[model samples]
Target: MGGIVPMRDAGRTGTLPATSDELSRLLTVVRRGRVLTVTGRFREPRSRLVREIARRLSSNFCDGAAVVAIGRPFGVRELTAALGCVPGMPFLPYGTADAVSWLAERDMLLVLDGAEHLAPEALAWLRRLLTAAPGLRILASGRSPLAFEGERVHRL
Candidate 1:
C-alpha cells in the first residue's frame, strides 16, 4: 500500500545475490516489464537477494513490493494469502484471479521463496497470475524454474 512492503524484515540476512553484475542486471530487468526468476536448490539465495534488492531500491522506487516465502507444500489459496493478498469475498477465496484483481495495475515486485515444492497445478495458476498482472514483476526462488512463457530463469 505504501512505498515499501510492510512485510519486509530488514533484519534477516538470507542468501545474498551472486555479485554486483548479476544484482545490477536483476534490478534492471525488474524495473522493466521482465519477470526474473532467481533459481537455486535452496531458498536462501533467492530470499536474501530479494531482501537486499528491496533494501537498496526501496529508497528509489515509487512502486510497491512484497516478498512471500513458500517454504513447503502449498496450494493456490495458500499462495495468495502467503503473498498478503487475501480474498475479500466468498466468490474468490484463495484464488489467483482474486490476487491479480487485488494487484490491479500497480507496479510491484513479488518474491516467491522456496518455490521448488509447488505442485504442477499451483505453478500453472502462477502463470495465470503473471499474465493477469502486466506490471507484476516476480523474483522466484526454486530448485527448478517455473518454465512459464517469457520467464527469465537464472540458475544459482
Candidate 2:
C-alpha cells in the first residue's frame, strides 16, 4: 500500500493559508538544514506546511521530493515500498540495511507526515537512514519532534 507521493506545490489553492512570516521561516529552515521537524498539537496542519515547504524546495534535491505517510508503525519494508522498491521474496524480507544502501546515493527530500506514533524500531531506522544518506534531507511533520541529532524543530 505504501508508495511515494510526488511533492505538489499547493500553490494558490487547496492549501491552508499561512502567514508570510511563517512561510519565510519555514523556507529558511528547509533550505539551510538537512533535517526539519515541524511540531504542533493534535489536529494541526503540520502536514500541509511540510508539503508546502517540500514543494518549494524540491528543486534543491537532484532526485526530487517525495512524501511518505508515517501515521502507522513503519519499518524498512514500508520505506522501501514508498520509495518504489518492490518487496522481494517473502522468505527474504527487505531490511533496514538494504533500504539504507538503496538510498545512500540519492539526493532527495523526504517528507514524513503523521509520525506521532512512529515505533521505536522505525525511528531507529530513520536515524540510520539519515546517517547513511548524506545527500538526503528529511522534513517531518508530527505532534512531537523526531529529535535527530541535527534536526531543526519549528513549533506551530
Q: What are the TM-scores, per candidate, against the unseen true structure?
A: 0.76, 0.82
Query: On residues 6-50, what C-alpha lDDT tens digit does candidate 2 reach at each position?
Result: 454333345553688888987888777888988888434786778
Worst-scoring 10-residue span by lDDT in model 2? 85-94
TM-score of candidate 1 to 2 decimals: 0.76
The best candidate by TM-score is 2
Error at 113, model 1, angstroms: 0.8
CA lDDT for candidate 1: 0.64
Q: How well does candidate 2 match the true structure in TM-score terms?
A: 0.82
lDDT values, one for every candidate? 0.64, 0.73
